[model samples]
Target chain A: MIRGWLSSRTDLPLKGDAASRFLPWVVAVMVYLAVLALAGALLARDSVLRWSRSLTGTLTVQIAVPAGERNLDVAMADRIDRTLELLRRTPGIDRAQALSADQISALLEPWLGGGAIVDELPLPALIDVALVPGARVDLKALAERLAAAVPGAALDDHGKWLKDLIRLALAAQAAAGLILLLVTGCAVAAVVFAVRTSLAIHRDVVEILHLVGARDRYIASQFQRHALALSLKGGLSGWLLALITLGGAAWALLSLDAALMPRPSLAWLEWLLILLPPFAATGIAVLTARLAVHNVLGRMI
Target chain B: MSYAGGPEIVSDLTFQLAAGSFHFLTGPSGAGKSSLLKILYLALRPSRGIVELFGRDVRTLGRADLPALRRRIGVVFQDFRLIPHLSALDNVALPLRIAGAKEAQVREHVSELLRWVGLGEQMNALPATLSGGQQQRISIARAVIGRPALLLADEPTGNVDDAIAVRLLYLFEELNKMGTTVLIASHNESLVQRFPHARLHLEGGRLERRTA
Candidate 1:
C-alpha cells in the first residue's frame, strides 16, 4: 500500500544533472567488463574440466626408433607391438590400440606438411591407452615392465603437459576473479559518487522529509530504488552486449578449421552462468547506494 | 545548543506545552525563536538540559523511536522549502505518503486540504511556478495535512498580504480547534497583537512566557 502511494504520489526519480549524466553509461561499462571476466572464468573452468576428463587415467606410449637407424621399420614394429601387448595385459587397461600411419600423419599434417621428404622422417609410433575409471594402475611399475619388455620403450602419461594445462586454466580463472572484484569496487565507487551528488542536490528535500518524520531507512530506500533501477538498466545492456560478443566470437571460431584448435562450445548450464555478473552488479549498486545514503544521513540529524 | 567553542544559543530553558494549547513565539531577529523551534522539532539538542515531548524524555528515546514522535509534530519553515520538482498536491501529500497512507486516502485528503487552502486550482502547479504567498501556503498545507499532534510554523504570514494572512491565521485556528497544539514564531508585533494566544517572548536565548 505504501509503495503504491509513494509511486503514485511522487515522480521524483533521482537522475543526475548534466554534470553527472554519464553515470549509467559508466555503470554499463563496468558491468560489461565484469560480465566478460565472469565469462572468461566460466570458459576457463569448462576447458579445464573437459581437458581433465579427457586426460585423466589415459596414457600415450611413444616408441621412438633411433634416428637414421638402419632397418627402422622392423625395430619400430617390434617396439610398438610389445608396448601394445604390455598395455593390453595390464589389469586396469581398458583399450590399447596402435594408431595407424594415416592417423599419425593427420595429427602432424597441420605442423608438418604432407610430402615425400616429411614421410622419410622417422616419427615415433604412438599407442593410445584408456584406463578404467578408478582403476589404480601403478604407473612406475608399468613403466619398469615396459622397459623390460621392449628396449627404447617409454610410457608417457602426459603428466607434465596436463599439470601445466591445469595450472594455466586455474591462473586464468583466478585472474578473472580478480577482475570481477576490481569491477565491483569501481561500481561501488561510482554508486557512492552518484548518491552523494543526489544527496547534495536534494539536501533541502531531505531536510523537509526529515522534518515531516520520514525515517532514515525510508529516505535511504528511495535512493536504493533509484540506484537499483539504473544498475538494472546498465546491467541488462551489458549482459546483452556480452552475449552478442560471445556469440560472435563463437561463430568466428566455428569458421576456422577444426584441426587448428579445440571447439569453443558451451553447455547450456555454462551459458546460464553468464547471467550471474549483471545480477551481482545490480545488487552491488543497490547496496552501495543504501549504505551511502544511510551514512550521509546519519551525519545530518 | 552551543556552537563549537561559542556561547550558548539557548540555556536554562525549562518549559512544557500542554496538549491542545496555542502560542505565538515572538522575539527580535537573532533572538533564537527559530533555534527554539528547531530544538522543539527534535532537530537540535540542547547542550545541558533535559528535553521532553509528549510526556517522554527525548534523551532517553532511541533513534528508532524518533520517527514516531516526529510524525506527531508538523513543522513549517520560514523559507517554505517545497520540492521544486513536485506539484503542490504531491508536496502536501508527502507526510501522508511517508506514513504509508493508501493512495486513495492520500489523494482525497490532499485534494480537500488544498481546496481548503484556496490552492485547488493550483494543485498541479510546481513550486517554481508558484508565487511566494502560494508557496508559503503550500508549505503550511503540507505541514498540517497529516493532522499532526503539534503544528509549528515559523513566520507563517511573513510573505502574504493582510487579507490572506488573516485567512491563513483562521486556517491555523481551525486546525487548533481540532486539537492540534499550534506554535507560530514571528517578529511582527501587529500580527502578534491581533492573536489572543499566549506569547513565548525570547531575549538573549532566554524565554519569558506571557499568557493572554
Candidate 2:
C-alpha cells in the first residue's frame, strides 16, 4: 500500500520513473503560509498568554469631583484613603493602592502635557487594584460603599474593555486556524485531482495491466506510491519554510521585548507538536493518492 | 453460466484444443471468431455451457480465481496491446513481472524471447519506434515469453508481411510442440489453407469443425 500510494503523482507511469510534483514557486507559497500558521499558533499559545497576564485581573479606578469644590480636598482625600482600606479588607481582593500625584502626573504626561505646563492641573484621582484568580468582585456594591464613605469616590472595574480585547485575540486565532485547515484541504484535493488526471491520460496503461493480468490494487499501488512521495516532499518543504519564517519573526519580537519574550523556548512537548507538519503532509498525500487512484480505476474499468 | 448476451460467439463450441493441440479459428470478418477466442483466453465469459481449462470450470470462476489461470494462458490481442512507454523488452517482461518473477529471471527470459522474435538489438526501443510488423512480433514475444500452457492469438498475422507471417506461424508451431494449446484467429483463408490444423470455423456466431 505504501509503494502504491507513492506512485500516484507520476505522469510517466510506464517509464517506471517518478517526477517531482513540487513546482518551486508553489513550494515557496506553501512555505510562506506554513510559517504564518506556525506563528499564529505560537502567538495564540504563549504570547497571547503573556499579553493577558500583563493586563488581566487588574483595574484603574478614576475618581472625579465636580469642578467647583476644590477646597473640600483634604477631608475627601482622608475619606478616599479610608474607603481604599475597606476595599483592601474585602475577600478576593489581592492588593489595592491609590495613585499618588507623581504617578498620575506621569500618566497624564502623554496627553495632558508634561512638566508642570499648567499651574493647576484638574485631574481625577486614580486607584489600582488586583484580584485573586477565579475570584469575583461585586463592583456595584463596592461603588455604593465607597460612595457612602466618600461621596466623591468612584470605582473603575476595567472588565469590559479587557474582555473585548481577549475576545478579539481569540477570534483572530480561530480565523488563522480555519485558514490553515482550508489550505491543507486544498492541497490534498489538488493532489487527488492531479493523480486522477494522470491516470486518465494513461488509460492505455490500465488497459495493458488489465489485459496482462495486473490487479487493480497493483496498478493503483504504482500510482499511489508516487503520489505519497510527492506529497511528503511538498509538505515538508512547505512546513520547513514556515518554520524559518516564524523563527525570524519570533527573533525580531524577542528583540523588541527581551525580558518579557515568553521564554524564547519551545518545550519538549511543544516540539513534538511542532513536528506534525510533515506527517500532516504525508497523511494528505496518502489520502489524495488513494482516493484519486481508486476513484478513477473504479469508474474506468 | 448464462450471461445476458444473446448469441454465443462460439455456439456449441465443444471441441477442446487439448494439450499440444493446434487449431485455426477462421471465418469472414465479424463472424465472432475473435469473440470465441476471447472466451477461450478468459477475457470473456461464455453465455452457456461449461468452458473448462486447467481442470477448473471457467464459467463459475471468481474474479480473484481467474488471474492464476489467466497467467497460465498467453493471449495476443489484435491491436498488439503493448504499453506505449515501455521498451520492447519491458513490454515482453510484463506478464512475468505480474507473475512475481524476479527482475533477473524476467530479464533473462524476455531478452532471449525478444531475440528469438528478431528483436534482440531492439529490446530497448519503445513500441512507437517499431514498425507494425516489429510491434506485432514483440506482442507475440510477450504472449509466448512465459511459455504458457495455452496461446490465443487474434489476427496474429494480419499486419505482418508474408515472410514475417510465416515466421510467426512457425513460432506458434514451436510453442505448440511444448504441450501448449495454440488457438489462432484469422480471416486469411489462404494462410489457414496452407497451415493444415484442426479448424474451428465460425459464421454468424455459430461454430463448426471444418477441414482446411
Q: iRMS of each prediction in angstroms?
A: 1.7, 2.7
Candidate 2's docking class is: acceptable
Compare the candidates by TM-score and give the number of the best one. 1
The ten-residue window of minimal lDDT in model 1 chain A covers: A2-11
**What residue pairs are clashing in model 1?**
none
C-alpha DockQ of every model = 0.68, 0.40
Please list the C-alpha lDDT of all candidates, in the order they appear: 0.84, 0.74
Q: Which residue window of length 10 is worst by lDDT in model 1 chain B?
A: B1-10
Model 1 vs. true fold: TM: 0.94
- Candidates in order, TM-scores: namely 0.94, 0.78
What local lDDT does model 1 show for residue A217? Answer: 89
Could you give me the TM-score of model 2 versus the true structure?
Answer: 0.78
CA error at residue A127 for candidate 2, angstroms:
3.6
Q: Which one wins on DockQ?
A: 1
Those runs of model 1 whose alpha carbons end farther than 4 Å from true positions after fitting are A1-13, A16-20, A67-69, A258-260
TM-scores for chain B, listed for all candidates: 0.96, 0.92
lDDT tens per residue, model 2, B47-125: 6678889889986776667667878888999999888878998889888888778879899989888888789999999
Worst 10 residues of 2 chain A by lDDT: A15-24
